[model samples]
Target: MIENNNLVERQYEAKNNDLAEEQHEIKKNNFVVDTEERENAIEPILGSELEGLDPSNYPLITPSIELTIKNRFSSWKIAKYYLKEYGRQKGFATKRYRVEFHRNRTVKKRTLTCEKAGKYKPNKTKPIGQQRNKGSKRTDCKCHVNLSSSEHTHYVHITFIYPEHNHTINADNKRFTTAFKHFDKSIMAEIEHAVVYGYCDIHMIRNLLQLKFSDQLFLMQDLSNAIQKIKCDKKVNRSDASHLLKFLLNQQKKEPTIFVQPLINVDSNRLCSIFWMTANQILLWSHYFDVVLHDNISRTNKYNFPLSLFILVDSEGKSRLGAQAFLNNETQESYKWVLQQTLDATSSEPNVFITDMDPAMNAACKNIYENTYYLYCIWHLLQNLPKRLKSKLALIEKYPNTYEYLHNTLYPTQQSWACVFVNRIFTVGMQSTQCIESINALIYKEVSSSLSMINVVEAIDSRMQKEALKCKFYNMEI
Candidate 1:
């Protein structure tokens, strides 16, 4: 019995020894892991210190260091990296330095500045509810860093530094900084193309950008500012009356009879009336002015001026532009000036004048061209017939004689619109002012309402050239 008990005790001791050895092995493995972790944590710090030991190797945070040309070429990325490293060394978050000023194209020089801390406020105003406004009261902290490009060296230099900060930095806020709020290069290129091609409106450009880059977010104000910058850079300003006058003068040099008369506003000394006709136009009018002359006003331009176009029928029965005038008002005085200018340019008067029922135009023609036969556009007279009859439809139904009287009074005779009663001598199968209306439609298609006076003139010139090309092609085929 004693031998068995001794054997059991020996077996228990051996099992206990085996368990102790296993625990010792586990503890040794744990110690190795902990030592490795400690070394790894210290390695980064040691490596950074040794690598950055030289002050010249990285940007200096000290304010005593004088700015040099070496800093002229420094970019925002470099400045940000420097700030982050300097902040890490000072035991503060990097984002505490907020970019405050960035020079756009409006300024002649390139500059960037970063404030030590963001804005802070207190419950200075009246409370709106149960809760009062609360925030850090450190509002006047003056720590900042200013960087500017050296004009002589073209290098970026640290012009100023005030690194001391009052508020604690928040590392959790990872929002993008305002300094980096800029369109990418590709986006700017697209904006330039759009602006150059006349899609310069801010709203239109924004929609275009949205379509092109749906993944990106663009604020309207930012896009406007960017467009303004581009305009400044390209020097694309609105064309004024002086520009128009200069262009006309150039045209007059080419065509001696290109008459331009500017009625100056006595109050502002600005152009109020302008009339022009090229020498070729004058020759064409002299040959074709007798058959039928169609005069109409188009109000599609940006200046809201009454654009008076005088058209004539050519030998081929095609509509040809004779003269154009821009009048400030539809008054008899402005119309007289425009008509007198047209007669003076062409040196001939049309036998038959067809025009809308504008009282001012009628009065002007009667006073200016006494011998010219005046004919009103029947379309204009008929436009009010429906409205006049609509209110008296029941009266017309009750009295057939009343309807006949109204129709006779309105039409009077077919001398105005009817082809059967037309004068075969003067009529080239033309009655209405459809020729001028079609010209206006074509002009409106190529020229926008926002175009300047110079652009309007250019668009008209382009249209005339296209017409000439079409004529040339027809002749070639003949």
Candidate 2:
């Protein structure tokens, strides 16, 4: 009887253990089902295209990439990009949480989490009046994705994912998230193209991009930031002055007859002035250098460097661009250097040099081309008459002070500007600096004060090319 009772007790103990095991297994399966159901509940509604797809046979990752584990990427950049896209799709922002780098500066591992992943701890030591009134966006979210790479592999792989977020994911709120504000490569290319060729301001650029990409969200500040970065990238390890010099040197290489002279300061070893003349410009100067018009355009570049243009009249009675210079200052020395460069390049001097009433330029012309007739632009002189007298001129009788002032100014400068006095010198029927002023206006249309030195050079070159084409066409017609 004792042996039978012992056997019964052992059987009962084994039966209880089996029942416990069965219950535990059921609970574990339920937990897994609950977790999966929760994940499915948070997923966005699929479009009609996915209506016939089977959930179990569906690809683990979508074409746009999903927050799924074991999804390998070629580099950490790609992995992070996918994470940002995933967050955008799910109506949340993502950020880098932690990164592990190897001694060689290569990435070993990285963790990306919801932007609201950590708690925003208020600075306890802050003064009461200095506390910010804006509420914090952080909610202590635990959702994150992990990436890893092994020593033998250079490929960045998504090793793990915790795809649950404590915050509600609203598609309408996606635009407010930083992740959705990110620009893709195509958008970046468009921005760069606009910056380079479109020549539009930031607001106009934003409007154009918004119109082109109707579905994309844009902020004025963000577009400005992007434009700044694009401009910086264009420099390519060179400053504006150095890049301009390099561009001119390259141009000279293409055409051996082209002349490029850069004046560097001995004390600072910095570029102070530069002059360039293309082969075609030299050819034009060789023919039309008898009556040269010179003037300066200020504020043509970011550095406010003064751009001087030389103009000459061709046989067809049309003005042609002869040469160009960028001077650091409007001093006599700078002007003299430019005139010397022009004379050296063409090996000829202008019979009549015309310019505005600039004393420095006049002195330089007198020093360099002593035999040349120095003529002043009558239009510029008349424009300055009122300013010199400190009053605007109406009819001479109405403003007698202006008449007297004009008489005084004109009597002294008659030989320099009076058409009758200058008739002795051949001027190609040109009297004023109107041709150079027109060229300056054309340059202003292409370049702005915000442009870099290199951009100013390129814009001026482009304008010169257009003029050259026009001249060639006219010559062909003639």
Candidate that would win on lDDT:
2
lDDT of 1 by residue, 1-478 (tens): 9999999999999999999999999998788777546644543221132233333334333332233333422344454455544444444433443334334422123332223355664435556675655655344555555655422222234556666666655432111223223576678888988776664455457789989877455655456557656865887656558867776876787567677777888998889978888776788888988855546455556788877788888888788878887778889998888888877777677788887767788789889877786776767667756655555665657556556746765466456556655655475666667677788888777566555676567566656655675676567546
lDDT of 2 by residue, 188-219 (tens): 88889877777544545778888877867776
Question: Could you tell me which 10 consecutive residues in candidate 1 have the lowest summed lDDT?
Answer: 171-180
**Candidate 1, lDDT over the whole model:** 0.63
Q: Where does candidate 2 have its weakest 10-residue lDDT segment? A: 53-62
lDDT of all the models against the reference?
Answer: 0.63, 0.76
In candidate 1, position 176 carries an lDDT of: 23
Candidate 2 stretches greater than 4 Å from native: 1-237, 388-412, 472-478
Model 1: colliding residue pairs: 71-156, 71-157, 72-155, 72-156, 73-155, 73-156
